[model samples]
Target chain A: MKMIIQPRDERTQPARIIAGYPQTPLRSPKEPLVKRAPTLSELSGPLEVAKRVKLLGGDIAGQGEKQAIGQLIHLRVRVLDEDGAPVGGAVVEMWQANAAGRYIHPNDDDHAPPDPNFYGAARVVTDESGVFELRTVKPGAYPVPTRDGWWRPPHVHFSVFGRVWLARLVTQMYFPGEPLNAQDRILNAVPDAAARDSLVARYIPPGVEPYNALVFEHQIVLRGRAATPAQP
Target chain B: MMIPTGEATIGPFFPPRYVDAGANDLTVFEGRKAKGEAIEIHGRVMQEDGTALENLIVEIWQADAGGIFRHPADPRHAQADPNFLGWGRAATDAQGNYRFKTIRPGAQEGRAPHINFMVMFSGLMRILKTTMFFEDGKDPVLMAVPAARRSLLIAKGNYEFNIRLRGENETPFFDD
Candidate 1:
């Protein structure tokens, strides 16, 4: 079979290029290989039923009937494909530390107390319009065991699965106006300031001010540049 | 249209709840066994320094024995196996070893049989995507790879492919 090799466009950077943390050392240099675009065969596959979607709720950190301790926030995300089309039925999974910067997992040895109410994870499927919403508390920043006492800025981790495996994406979402954004190595790894800014969620006002819950809007673009821009 | 968004790592804190009870087994779906030759793909996740990378998550998606995937986008005429989910996700053990129980995927679009893999771990700026081919298959994708590095993409009986994140034996990665 004959193969046509193409050069990678300079505009879109792969994740490995921008992942500049100590844990993830840079990859060794090698000849650039053509990334075969997804063929119809690759597109044909079963979309896993949204079994994890049952965990979706406004209170990720909170247990049944127990609200987590922290500032209340509402998060809304839209999933889109490379064509700038809404990708309905895609799964969006998110995990984050509690307001105190503590995770409920065993590996998280951080001294901060794990909020008993916070489950720390939620999974939901985008609706027909490609949107998923969750009500949760703002997470806190915590120190990591990297060199120089590296502290991870408050952020939410996201895993998105589109129609096929080729569209899978995993990234972190940051809050806008955080002072630590300037110093975070991971966020800074992306050379493009606009791309990095897309990771920050924008605050939106809720209709009822008395409710006092913070609202943030963010969107995830699945594939190529033709898809909706990462951040608008 | 906007530029494609950059990738990010799946940090160390992936919740345990993400793993479903039978996520590692693709053959067994709702008590009905998928039709095909059941095989196991096993390997370890290692860093460039040769240290074991435990707790990493690996997910695989492929076609069924009939060369049909369960996905809605597949335009092929092949019939998808009702009993096959065609997708599975597993995490590496303390020793960085991971395994998946699945059938040999059939060929599609004149291409050789292969399975797609996505690797995620803390510190990964984005998930790593790669494909695994059976040693016996005459896949052009495998043939196009350098002769010396082709072994890194092939799985023999019992199927083992140790992933080296970077370094001398850094596994070849693909663009989306």
Candidate 2:
């Protein structure tokens, strides 16, 4: 079945080419994005990605006797489609810096210390209700690796593969009220406050089981599947 | 509540743990070869100045040799080749070269067989969605693209599709 996919709302999204972000000027096309009709290629995607990639489970802090260092936090992420319906079996790949705001990658030459107990990468699949939880140390705000005078706010990078190809999303989830978020070029790339606010996770006070970690809940809305034709 | 979430870069420091070794070879999976004509997709990802964009993730999704999508949405998806891994991901090397070992997809009705490429990397604020047609024919979708730039969507010389992030001859991108 062919799908009538929806076009992105450019206003609520970042400009195709953003300024001040040095990479955009070199990476973005000078011409406007081409609009095309949807095809099965865009409607279909790989299934069981988490199975192929292997799920690292919800614990990114590792199984060491000594847990990762820094503020313990639990992140609850729920993925929804454009119609506000849960996306089940979606693969949510998350990677972030450790408590000191340093990544395990060799390229992360930031002055922060990398925690041996934290590799900082996890693949969690949303349950039938489109919910997944992650437990790790709060990533610290670090200076951009580009060595620009800017400090990026504490954020977790997310790569989600929804049920269909059209629903694919690679985005960042920001913490609320972070000082650097105001100046973070990536976060400010989208001029709309409401759109920017959607990137921030809501704070829920720490109190429940595994009570040591504060909880931050975030919701990600992917492009919805096109309307299916009615059956006779 | 229904608003789409904002986009962000995948960052240069792709977690090594996510780089599954030999994930690019989709021609075979689980000790079995897919039933189709195997092909190689080789390409480089460069910046506006032609600087190699290393560690960039290039993911491809395509139909089977029969143009049957393994996705359940396809009415005949059940007929899809079980050994065929419909999609795969590969990270560019130090020199910005990424390769995919897969089969040539069969053309869907009224369309040409092609591979869908989604690129993600640091500084790319949004996901880059594009397609690579095996050969130019009467693909209607390609018709919508500017004629002068349509060749940018076609892979040149033995499936060598280099992706230039910007500048002259920049690859055309689409919104999903």
Predicted candidate 2 versus true structure: per-residue lDDT over A1-232, tens digit per residue: 3434577677678765666677788887777777887776787788767645767789976555868888888998999887777788899999988888899998887598878888888988999889999998888989875676788889999999977887789999999879888898888888788998999999997676668778899999987644763344
Candidate 1 residue spans exceeding 4 A from truth:
A1-20, A26-34, A51-58, A61-65, A147-149, A206-210, A224-232
Question: Which residue ranges in model 2 land beyond 4 Å of their true spot?
Answer: A1-4, A146-148, A225-232
- How would you encode candidate 1's per-residue C-alpha lDDT over B46-96 as one tens digit per residue? 877788878889888888887787765565534788888888888999999
Report how closely model 1 matches the true complex, as a DockQ value.
Answer: 0.51
Worst 10 residues of 1 chain B by lDDT: B70-79
Candidate 2 has which clashing residue pairs, if any?
none
Q: Could you tell me every candidate's TM-score relative to the true structure?
A: 0.89, 0.95
